[model samples]
Target: MMIKWFMLLFTGFAGGLAVGCGFVAFLSVLGIIPRLMQLTKTIKWIRLYEWAVILGAVSGGWFSLSPVYLHASHYWFIPIGLLYGIFVGMLAAALTEVLNVFPILAKRIGIDDKIVMLMMAIVLGKICGSLFHWLYFAGL
Candidate 1:
């Protein structure tokens, strides 16, 4: 029984580490952090950015597996939500830029001349969707 429990725990730890490494590798391959740093002109804070990513990943995993809750007021959610939106927006931008997705999509859709408009539409749609979600689902 003891050996079985030890093996199970070890396996779980190994699996989690593997997944975490893969996630980090994926972000690195996507050049998300570097792109963000370049755009923000914070190349000197590279270590800080790296540490933030590592800590965020670990904290996210821990929070997901643990039954921890924050007792913050609804007002605090505004900044939190904004930060989440910024991170998601940056990640999406990085991925699209890295893969040249926008150009390819524009060419394929015969909207090469209106690529800027297409991008603006996507941005506006995302903003509207977020607003709707916050207003309807979150009641905020």
Candidate 2:
């Protein structure tokens, strides 16, 4: 139980940081930011965002899997993780279509950035994954 709270807070913070950094870098690269900045010449922010993304995903993966670690046999977590991956993918795809905000924002910004979609997908996946794990344990 203590470990669960720790993982929750850790992943939440890590994911939030990544999402925030990604949002800023995304806006800059997507041409949404005002032309005055011209920040693309220096891709240091992009590097920071990329590393944040990798860090967040890894940390959140550990955080997200804490439940399975607690309840499952040593080998069960492996298959469960694979199943969760599939579920996250499907949830992400459906969410992107339903939200519609990304496309409109991108259209307004005047550039089609695929990375924008990728970032949104990651966030949606994490949220949906948390719910899925909750439901799984609740049902058992």
Candidate 3:
């Protein structure tokens, strides 16, 4: 095999974590997360929030797969890719929530969210990377 599974797994996790943290930090700095969290307070804007997540996931899925992306002449590819994107976005949101919610843990653990984010990213990346690797190896 030209690829090592463990390396890919490690790299995926690290890369994902970095990207996730950076994305969250970027959102937080923009005050978007607070605004987003506040959407739960009222009945309004929740739909907007949901739509944002869906859109984010869809966009994420599209970009990530775009690299080695096959030409999708089939109509199903778009919808299917969107579903995968939704999955990615949800997973990413969950990771962001965990780190943002807990500050004391980082102090106590003497580590940072960077590491935590990295771990989370690794998991998300690993899952997705596995799929990618399989596709690449299988000549899909």
Candidate 4:
């Protein structure tokens, strides 16, 4: 039982980290956020805000997977988790824009025409991370 729990936790953490990093890298490549905030003083705060958003996304995704991971045995759960992450990420971005919320994040990250692209990257990362556990079970 203890091993099972550990496995679950490990899976969750790995998924979160993978998704977060991938999403951030994709955003940088797309020029949605500055490519070199590491070198810029004014945009330094944006890096912090970006981290917060990615962390929040990872947490949200992990929570979303908890029930399925605990109860389901099907490998399709992996793809489902990925799809869920993508859906949630896109929804979060859209809702934030439509509601005019997340102004702090927007201001810090430097808004561009590529918001949709960035959102897609975030969603894809989330899904890919969750898919790992799904594939693990499939091997079993």
Give the per-residue Cα lDDT of candidate 3 at 23.
74
lDDT tens per residue, model 3, 68-112: 666767667658866877655654555455456445555566667
List candidate 4 segments past 4 Å from native: 35-140
Candidate 4 residue-wise lDDT at 96: 49
What C-alpha lDDT, on a 0 to 100 scale, does residue 132 get in candidate 3?
89
Sorting all predicted structures by lDDT, with the top scorer first, yields: 1, 3, 4, 2
Worst 10 residues of 4 by lDDT: 32-41
lDDT preference between candidates 2 and 4, better one: 4
Full-model lDDT for every candidate: 0.89, 0.62, 0.64, 0.63
| TM-score result, candidate 1 | 0.88
lDDT of 2 by residue, 1-140 (tens): 99999999999899778977886675445443232123234454666655755676677767876865466585786688668775555444444544565677677767576757756666777868777886688674
lDDT of 1: 0.89
- Residue 79's lDDT in candidate 2: 84
Candidate 3: the clashing residue pairs are 13-122, 16-121, 17-121
Candidate 2 lDDT score relative to the true structure: 0.62
Residue-pair clashes, model 1: 0
RMSD for each of the candidates: 1.7, 15.9, 16.0, 14.4
Best by lDDT: 1
C-alpha TM-score for every candidate: 0.88, 0.29, 0.34, 0.31
